[model samples]
Target: MDRLKYLLSPIKIRNMELANRVVMPPMGTGLGNDDATVSEALLAYIRRQAKSGAGLVVSEITAVHPSGSVSPTHLGAYDDRFIPGLRKYAGAVHEAGGKAAMQLHHGGRESFFLLMQGEAIGPSAIPSVVYRQPPREMTLKEIHEIIDSFGRAARRAREAGFDAVEVHGAHGYLLTQFLSALSNQRQDEYGGSFDNRARFVIEVLEAVRKSVGNDFPISLRLSAEECIKGGYTVEDIQTILPRLVNAGADIIHASLGTHGTPAGITSAPAEYEPGFNVWRAKKIKEVISVPVITVGRFTDPALADEVIARGEADMVAFGRQQLADPDYLIKAKEGRTNDIRICIACNQGCIERLMLEPGSSVRCAINPETGQELIYPRTLASTRRKVWVIGGGPAGLTAAYEAARIGHTVSLFEKEEKAGGQIFYASKAPYKEVYDAWIQWLIFQVQAIGVEVKTHTLVTETMLDEEQPEAVILATGAEKIIPPIPGIDLPLVCDAFQILGDEVKPLRNVVIIGGGMIGMETADFLIDKGCAVTVVELLPRSPVKKFASHGYMLHKRLRDGGGRLLLGTEVVAIREDSVVVVSEERGEEVLPAEQVVIAVGTRPRNELKEALSERNIRHFVVGDASGPRRIIEATEEGARAAWDI
Candidate 1:
């Protein structure tokens, strides 16, 4: 099949015309400045995505009313005060030759710290399991007010020069809550049967259509299935589609799962493959006459093309994939697919920002210039500098590539004859092969940028002094910590890092000490290799506490994959063929194993930094070499250091 047949085709939706079928779906960026104003940084971020050749760019979820706000810094279409900034955002997208659409939404019970001042409001007084708080039930007057709010928001969106407006009626938000029986439980006109449950969204869509005229495109994002027992199913959505079309929804953007069930929402592995949610879209598209846009893990352009070519979706929406590589469309158009950075689906950088660092804004794992588009541009300097980078890990490779791109003659050193650092081991786990692709991309990028790479070559202070032309970057990375438990030096004992990295291979019946991210992943990897794995942790819930919701999902997969997890248990002794652990509740227990794999954290390799400091050389230590942090921290630090140089 011709992959680019439909994807490269120009499509017209209402009055708005798109150059292609690629759509950058609305995702919360959390990059707005205080007072809910769009900053130049946010504008540049969206412009870059549009410039990257997306057919359409959807703005982040914008609150239709003050009570619908999810974050204080989130973009809002509620007030007239936001129109000017949104106009600027629209101009940026239009200037980049892409249609801009604003997504109008109400958080309902999902409104976190903002909106109701930590309180939640919904169609009914049902408590959300995700939030653990019951929402204030909306009265008939309040419902009418909300419907008007949506219309006003749509009018504001049109005034802001947006090409189209998408009503977010999915993902267990306000309109979705009204549509689902699980969340809505109301006896009023907006509850009970499917038609009553879908009434609020239908009315809101009608109100929006009435406000924006017949020519303006009004799309509805609906969950085909909540993926919960009592929630709306695909059949229910199929039944309601005709009514929604009658109400005024020009396009049906189909998505799945509800926010109430984290597992269902985050880990709903229907196909457990890339672009897995396209099947749901295909199901919806078959019955609907209106155009259907499918989102959820549509990373690969070829796969996205298949979805459109096979008549599964009229438009393909990319969320995190575009986050990773905003210029993905442009790269594909230019036949530079290899240069496009693929998102590994590790939500640590993107999704975690929504929870832990709400005000900091979302960013990509590989692209350091994501939210910093106003500050960082992909351009070369007027003059070139000679740069030497030690190590070939994520941080080092990133630094070398950035330095080379900025008109620098970069030389990268790797002592191990390969790159990837500790990430090489992390990727060996089951279902984590996607991570290896990232490492490959990094190496490819560094090489593509004309960076001179030296493998199996150690760089020391003397080497730095000898090659002293400009700056030196130290990215030596971290080493695994070997605890001094009794009989820890047994022949059968091994480091999880060493084993996963293929430096050592154990026979069977492995005991992984420390139930952290690495330990759990190692257990899963070992189990796949036909080993009975047991994980012992001193923490109450394993050190996977630091992991994001997606990581927890991966952890659950490991647990269900036949690996025994013993949380709140400390390993006191390691025998040649067994491990003794003290559980907080179950007293002492001896677990038999053929091999003991220790995954108990890591420490910074500060020796290189100390040497550099002693030599008084111009240098910066990044990645695990500075501190045992994640790849996001490493890549950020590496790019910053390289940019500074």
Candidate 2:
């Protein structure tokens, strides 16, 4: 607690005094009503976040106009009619004992929904690198109208009882498009020079200040640097930071990257080091008198404290960390650091779900109650039951822990000598040590809550009948699918599971069948081990291409490391020193391989399901026992099944 003095200290920004330096930065949740009004679900989520003890909870991005909307459910502050709901939003945070701020944003060319409707607008007629849709350049008259819209929105925020307002000028939005030379090519007043590029946001800040009054605090969120070639750097933007601050910005929320920036830098996968952008914030703070808020891959409070103690920034924003554990700051304040459920930055449930799945709200892969504040179980069970959870994978561990948490007598059994099931092997892959920490956390939770765990013990029907457990949760996990190829039984052949589990050491040359996530990951793992690898997939394209951020990163790394990915190809047979493959372009080919690894996929391993059903046992099947899926599904199913029990 003493070491976290800087992080736990109080700070004052304008008239609002924050209890601590922690800030829950704005994170978009597609939980608003279709008409762009606040919903009960969104309110519940915000209330829960506020209860986390953050000094300030910046609400999700709210559009200033319809043309700036990213989705039909994007929260709006364009009209006065939204004030009542916005007031409720502020009340939710205030009542929970936290300050509230509304993030005002315009998506510009990044507004996919607006582009689909042919109504996208930006400072210049430039297409966003991610969206690839050219936006209609705003006329001088239209620019003033949007600036006025921002002012009106700020006034509405103040009227709605918000402590402050944040002008979102980063991440390749309308303001960023104007500021960046890569996006803005206009020859008019809003372009051609640094002052011209900075004109729109500064004028908007002035408008917002005039609307909100002199005493109100306004935070300007900016990408410390564009983080891409041909884009503005922090040094180039330092000259404008002071000018914007002079225009009425009270605080600078310094972040990194734009829409086209790699995930390794922006949203940062597990491979990225924590506090990667603190230097950028330090740079911004050097030229500005206002306090700076740095945000980027900050999960550990100790790291945040170090950043503040070093004066890199006055505050730190833990975005995804708040989603994973709403009580993050509270737990840290209590010195229960190990008890905190740290975010692994996998981007599965939050970013991927938000972008790839329409109508889905923000969620955490590790925490099932993230967006389910209104529905997820909280109270203890009315009648404590004797629950037996089979298997020791993520699903079983979570089920055991959650059941114990809900005041049930839970016993978990694992057939293997050690627990962690698939996650045990997954952690062995390159750049996935985070999974190891996750499994350890799950196991620690189960053990800490007094859940009885028995390893090297496979639950049988006879044992269940003898014990007479009231309920059973079968999370037996899955088994790797072995294709019935001609020479699959050769001595040089094995499944990816064996390789990942360290049961098999492949030779210098290796061939992997499948081009899915696991297959690509295995190739990457082998490539790291100095193995010449080739991946073959029967599908026309990689499944990972659907969300190419992490996939492309993996693909690029694999190709750069000399790994071959053969799409639309099938494996025919395995030979002593070679494997036969067939593709559309090439009828048949033989590839030399010292070893062959199968990574097609997995199937549910529910052998006990029929046996338990025959005995009329009250049981629920969860996780891979139902179907092979991602860790998100497994943890969610586990928690839900435990609640049901």
Candidate 3:
């Protein structure tokens, strides 16, 4: 507990005294009201983060103006009418024994909902990579008004009882659009040179300082490096850090990348290492007198503490990690780091959910109670029941853990030698070692709660009848959906499970029959094994588009590695040494391949449910047993089913 000396040490950002160096940076959850008010859901979410014992909990993207809104559910501080809601938001954090900071944001061209509703405004008429709608150039008057908007928003945040306010000048938003040459092509004072591009940002900071007075802390969060070609690098941003400080910025939240980058360094996936952007923060810290907060996958307190101890940055921000486990900092402080449920940076539950399904609140794949703190039960049930759970995948393990935690005697059965199930095989793929960490943590949690785990033991109807449990949770998971292909029975053909589970060695020349995430990942795995891979899909485009950023990276990696993709192509027949395919563009073609791998998808493995029903037994089916979906659904169903008992 005493080891995180500098990390657990108290620090002051101007007049704001932080209890520790651990910060919970702002991450948007679409839980706010449609009319831009802070909903009770938002309050509950923040209260949980505040109670996590973080030194500073910054509010997620509060719009400085309605035109800057990214989504209808985004938090707003554009007008005095929103002050009351903002007051409760600040109060929730304050009452939870934490310092609260509001992040003032203007999305500009990156504002999706605003663009959908009306014209998106920016310094120039450039569009962001993610949001391709070209924004209208802001006139001088409009620019001045937006600068005043930032000041007013900061004032409103201070009035609402927030300890500090952070200016969101990063992530290819309005301010970053003006700051970077990639987006800014203006001929006026707010463009052209570095100083000109920085004028708007400095003025906003000065306005905020004038509005909030000298003592109130004002943090400037900017991407130290844009993480793309033709974008401003850390050296360029370093030149202006002193000017920003002179303009009354109390702290520098040194982050990386913009929304324009396809490989969003902003919220990295499992591919990136922890503290990957600390060097950028260290660079910014070298030039600035103010405290610097480095953020980028700082999942572990040991890593965060090391960053601070090495003087890389003044503080470390545990962004998604705190979402995964609200008690992340508390446990780290108490020397119970192993108890913390680390965020694996899957991007499936939090960022990907927000991007794919608009208006959805933040969620975590492993921890189901992230944005559902208000609805999820925290107290344990009084009644105890003997519960039996079948399977040992994410759902089964989670069900067993939750049931055991809720004062239930739980026993889990798995046919496999290990407990991870599908995820165990999944971890064998390259850049997927994080899933192993997740599995280990999960198994530790289950065993720690006194759940009796029986691995390498398959449960049958006879076994269930002999046990005679009060309730049974079936998390038997899913199996791959192998399509009816003529040559699927060939010795050279195999399913993704076979390759991933090490049942079969990687092939030399491979043809993948699907282009979904799993297929692309399989190709990636085989490519790593020095295989020449070709993906054949009946769809016109890659189905992995559901996961945009990750898909983009995977597709790019596939192409870079000389992998071939034939879309809108149907496999007519499979031959001994080739696959015959027909496409509209290319009438017919014979692609040579040594092996065929099927990664079509999966189907529920819930045959036990029907048997249980026939036996007149009370039971619940969860995870892949209910439906083949992502880990989020699996965790939710498993935990909910356990709670139902």
Candidate 4:
């Protein structure tokens, strides 16, 4: 009678009873204190997700050893001193009517040498791709000490009120380093052959089980495929799965691909489908009786339910989805799926921030309240008023919807027929249609809140003067900045907007003037279109250097697709069949191309500033119109502006 209600069904793992099959997988948010013990921030974040009505919430990686800590803010369970804070975390989850688990972690060779305060140690000497450390081989004594640490961590987890304890065996952590043949090159019992390679994990599991006893539930996270050359695959997991289960693992939480492997930094990249790793979980499910928790971009509740309905996975772990919308399960159970914010898998805020930025706290691009759980909107304004939001981009849409939700009569005006001004073209890249989903949600929320959206209507100062709104939010966004080089206006030359929109059809050989995110994304699109794309930039390094993860993956894809990049080059002029450029390395040069695309950057379109000033209207500005920035800042400012009005 109901469509896909199985996602709200109950489940059990050993001694722990979950309210539903929905599990919030462990995703580090840098919420803990400097000592890596639980802080109020971590408690608040866990409480928010637990309040979402998930069946289970697995707190982010809890370091079992000092060297295992990823950052100063990573959660810790290595000693009894950390038990009190962790107890509070588990208690809050219990108060929210959800089961909680603690994932014991040890980075092994993947450890940050600088943060570890010593040389990283693994099963064998291997170079760390993430921390750039030359790790030494671990001795038998060190191996036993780490095993004892995991055992102690599990004991602490049980004492701290956790319903279950999960071993962070995946993600190229200590256990994985010993499991993967590429990383494990030791001659000891902890390395070499398949059985030997798995010995370390088995020992840790045995120690943990010996400490927690048979009554406590135990889970192990495993990577079904390493996605790296000469690395393990699903067959490896098929064999490794039984070893873990036999070693007292009551549940198998199957995650996909290892970090620092060829798969890149994110477990769920933007290119992956909603249940990309469900097939892997299914493979494990076929061989083992233990419940398998499948995790990989399972954002859509319908898709999540299908995984269980078809018997693909026993549980669905929503990591980024829960971060984007803490009320995801609650909304779905209430038959209000439309109210749930889609994750969209834009790594800009979550994983990208975690991997690239040092000491960065995890935040959501769509949901600004992710890490700020303690500071919530108290109440919507009781006094209603007229509100005008200019431009229907993310900022304007957010302001309009938020204002209306605050009991304001709001109107949003867009010059284009559709909303998502810049995002419209930005989403044209491969597998980027997810942005459209976010835009759709924004449109739905604004319409549901009764915000009058006047699209294809350009509002001027005269219109604002006549309406005389109590508040005006200017989100006009920005415009592409065309360099003042000679022949810049040539028909053969166009900006990334035109190229992405297919307005200016790219020629066989194309040379772009910029190497920023917009430029690189456009270049990637052109390279896929069988065009020879060459990006020439004025900077010596990547212009989008701040976007470490995005820049790394994007540039790699472009280069792999036969794209050429010329950094430290300045465009002098755009000719009929070639573009003249100058670089420090190569003083003067002619880059022959049929099309010269300009993607240097954008300049703020604040023309409405003087217009509103003349009208003498009460106004505020946000988003690109204020200054070109990311979606998070724009949306946050929009919501803040609405509350201020």
Q: Which candidate is the best by TM-score?
A: 2
Give the CA lDDT, 0 to 100, for residue 42 in model 4.
75
- lDDT (Cα, tens digit) per residue for candidate 2, span 1-645: 386899989999889999989999999988899999999999999988889888888989998877788998999999999999999999999998889999999998898888978899998888887788899999999899999999999999999999999999998899999999988888999999988999999999999999999889999999888888888999988989879999989989998789888653667777777898899998898888799999988999989999999999999999899999998888888889999998988887887788778788888889988887778778999999999999999899989998999999999999999889899877877778988998998888899999999999989888987998888999999999999999999999998989988899877999999888788888888999999999999998887673445676778878889999898999999999899999999889999999999999999999999978887878889998899988888888998999988
Please give the lDDT score for candidate 2.
Answer: 0.89
- Compare candidates 1 and 3 on lDDT and give the better one: 3
Candidate 3's C-alpha runs over 4 A off are none
What local lDDT score does residue 396 receive in model 3, on the 0 to 100 scale? 93
Q: What lDDT tens digits, residue by residue, belong to model 4 across residues 359-444?
A: 88888888767887776555778778888999998889988987888688999999998988888887888877888878888888
lDDT of every predicted structure (CA atoms): 0.82, 0.89, 0.88, 0.84
Model 4 vs truth, CA RMSD = 2.6
* TM-scores of the candidates in the order shown: 0.96, 0.97, 0.97, 0.93
Stretches of model 2 off by over 4 angstroms after superposition: 546-548
Model 4 per-residue lDDT at 36:
84
Worst 10 residues of 1 by lDDT: 262-271
Error of 3 at 186 (Å): 1.8
* Model 2 superposed RMSD (Cα): 1.5
lDDT of 3 by residue, 1-645 (tens): 378898889998788999998888989999999999999888888888889888898999999998898898988999999999999988988887789999999988987876776678988887777767888999999999999999999999999999999999998888898899999999998999988999999999999999999989999999888888999999999899899999989999988888867666689877789999998998997887789999998888999889999999998998889889998877877889889898888877898889778768898989988888787777777788989999899999999998988789999999989898789767776788888899899999999899999999988888867878888999999989988878778888888988988899877999999887678889888988889999999999878773366677778878988999899998877878888899999999999989998898889998888778877777999998888877878888999899899
Clashing pairs in 4: none
Q: How much lDDT does candidate 3 score?
A: 0.88
